[model samples]
Target chain A: MKILEDEKIVGLFFERNEKALRETEASCGALLRKTAKAILESDSDVEECLNDTLLSLWQNIPPAVPKSLRAYACKVIRNLAFKRLEYGLALKRSINSELPLDELEAVLFDLKTENEFSDVEFTLTLDSFLGSLSAESRAVFLKRYFFCDTVPQIAQDLCISESKVNSLLYRARKKLRSVYEKGAEL
Target chain B: MKKYRLSKALGEIDEVYIEEVLKYTEDAAAGKRRGIFGRKRIVTLALAAVFIAAGTTVTFAAACGGLQSISEHFTAYRTDIKGVGDTSSLPVIENAWSIGKTMDGEQDALAGSIKVTSAVCDRYSLYATIEFNAEGIDIPENIPDEELTFDIINAKSGIEGACRPVFVSREGDIFTYIIHFSESSSINGDEIFIEAHNFGRSCTVEIENIGRRLVFNSVEYCRIKFSIPVSDLLILDSVQSLNSEKIDGIIDMDAELSPFGFVVRYDESQVPAWEEAHSELLKQYGWEWFKYSTGTVYSLLSFKMKDGSTLENVHNLIATAESGSDPNSGKDTIHFSFIVPVDISQIESVTYLGAEFRFDAEAYD
Candidate 1:
């Protein structure tokens, strides 16, 4: 599962190695499954998401060499689980996540509609949303979500005023809460 | 969801989703490690399926600065040129005769002859290997690739039939050439010359050399290079030009393709498989074909009729098999054999099996 270990095993994945693929799933199974479970709250949905995520990873990784194999798994599973969550909604009209949904609500609100990042159906939507936010807003968001980046770390990472990180967090949360209640239809 | 789980999920989103994203970080890291030499040789078999890119060991400085030059000339047609010559330009080609073209575009030399198919002036150090079998060629698009071809001819002009090369050195029997292209490929107005030299039994044709060194080691799959010679020209030297305009004209030959002979010559063991237009053969050669457990694979027959005359006429005719075992493997080397068409000289284009096909093979010598 490690991207840059020995190139032979890496080559197996590159060669569409079925055994190495089976091993990849087995190796990363626990973390991927647990991550999916936390987001979807359904074992069946989590399993489905894990399978889809792995398949996409298998298909995409040859061209896209990930820096951190673990981060790669996280990015894929999160986006897929989120997309499935959107589709399983009671109605397309309920485009916004409920504030109580808690985890993805902040990032989801700032994100553009899914159709905007069409070719990049995998992670493009999230990337665009993160890009559109101010550098401060994104740093705080990643600190809270992407990296569990601490307040001090975010301050260091952003080279910014510590208060700026705190304020960006508060503003992002407030906007997400309103958008969640309004339920932007898209 | 549990509170602990929720926090964990939020904190790990980037890690969770890494699989599906196209991360180019590895490639970027390669560039930073050592300018060009520090970079890993990533042979991305992106589009060309069987293309074997060994991240060719191109010298670092040469690769970076020469990539553009490598691609441009490799994509263009080359013509025959020579800077030095002990040759002649008169009515006699082998000292005692002249080659004469028939009214129907057929050529005749007394007994011995050598004709230049095409040639080009190459300036870059490149190596090429071109092979012709039934399975077509597979040239790497972004790598330096080359192919050379040659034909035998007689030098005498008084003899009226069957002319071949005169005194083709053992080294001269093989011609040599090179090509290097990257990223994109073009198929417009390209030509290469196959020299019929008297160098020896083998050919001694010269190819490209860059940075002032001859690239003579990197050849694969053909012997035409024996008759060719790599000239010592650090600067581009125009190859002696011939009246032949371009070498892109197709060859129409009735001579059975070599792979066709592999099966037909050994038809004793698998007669049943050979009956129908062998579906498995077609599939093996990367054709869209299907095979039943029994006699449903091949659909082509030798065009038979109630009359014996039609049967006789069809004996040496050609038709491609439409079936094979595994179509996508592209490891197919179907076996077959048939007489070379007597009127092969009338046709100009190289004839291939009757289907849309692309091979790891390149231009003919």
Candidate 2:
């Protein structure tokens, strides 16, 4: 199916056309489901979260015109999925021993209670840190942390071994830890 | 400070990063080629299995039995070759021919001899297994897991391409290495030179009995060269003219079917209006124009097969756009390679842009 462009879809949302939701789902539903499925274990919860993401896009696009609709929908779905996982709305299925959430623990370990940096400042720091990485490493980092992709899924997609994926994640986390420590010190 | 907070912060980073990641996932989900070289180690191993199964008798004493023999003593290196032990069982390793040419290597001080055992090539890349024999040398029991690097130098042009060691294994005194040579440009040549370097520098052998490492500091101790002929590898070609309303211009596409994958080449210069729109977007958004672009030209190219399956996500191995003297002339050639090797006979029609071009089955014969 030839999916509509992001601009057209966003225009539909602004015009209050119901077709906008279907178009957005057609274009980004797979990506949103994959991202949400990585976090929320249950199928029902994932469907619920996806519906919420579509509604959120419908509600927010008129007042908030995003630069990229796919990126905006992805952000919404991920936020909703993480919220579902945190609020005990869904039973967390075991996604390997080292969950992506737990993997970030070491990076922010030094920033315990006294860290006062705002989320925006931290995001900027992260942006700079991501900029320093190689393109391949940055993709792997974002895929694991942001998209919550499993190691095997990433390995298969990238045509690399599971060990290599783990290695990239390990090195990226180590670098992120150093960046986080520097930010905390500031 | 919280993990959720960190995750949320990451979500708020520049949309460029998010878009980049999304592009990778989309391509991957669609089974598109992942990296620039697009040399999948499993695919290489699968090619090796196909070559051996096709009854190409390689003359090398060490790597003659193909991946099966090498896996017996296979040791994991930094870059692990996935599924080396079970290449023959893979269902994807089909419709490939074998190249059983044996090329003699230059004798070196580090070892007795080096030779190219089993070899295969597609239009874009070359895969070969090299056997390094270290006979009559006081070798160490423990060899470092470091990779042995090499270069594929064109015999005629002398242009060099980097070679990656996909798999490495050791017997008593001989070491076997399966390497892949891929370049951004077509790796076309009648003959090529394989220069294996950094043998002792990068790969150090630890003399366990003496409790010391045997590091060959001299370049002669590490370097070995081999010359091989690659003229026998088959690449099928066809030309078709396609006009699509979805795209601004007519497409004169040239498709090449190699043992590895399909390479679809077309001149985008024919579409002047489309090129102008692309230029306008680039001028408007700078580096961020890629995010705004609706879809890539390669996305419009797919295959309709004889098995009643349409192969989507033809992973573009490499896309190079070359412009003439007049930049606005929009003279550009795009090459898209399928992720997996499809039987040329099975490809019934090619959908280029919005136009469908049918193929005669007798052409593949």
* lDDT top scorer: 2
Q: Candidate 1, after superposition: displacement of residue B96 in Å?
A: 99
lDDT of 1 at B22: 20
- What are the candidates' individual DockQ scores? 0.06, 0.16
User: Which residue pairs show backbone clashes in model 2?
Assistant: none
At residue B315, give the lDDT of candidate 1: 19
Question: Which RMSD does model 1 reach against the true structure?
Answer: 25.9
Runs in model 2 lying further than 4 Å from the true structure: A89-98, A111-114, B1-3, B28-365
TM-score of candidate 2 relative to the true fold: 0.41
Full-model lDDT for every candidate: 0.33, 0.57
| Model 2: residue A46 alpha-carbon error in angstroms | 1.4
Candidate that would win on TM-score: 2
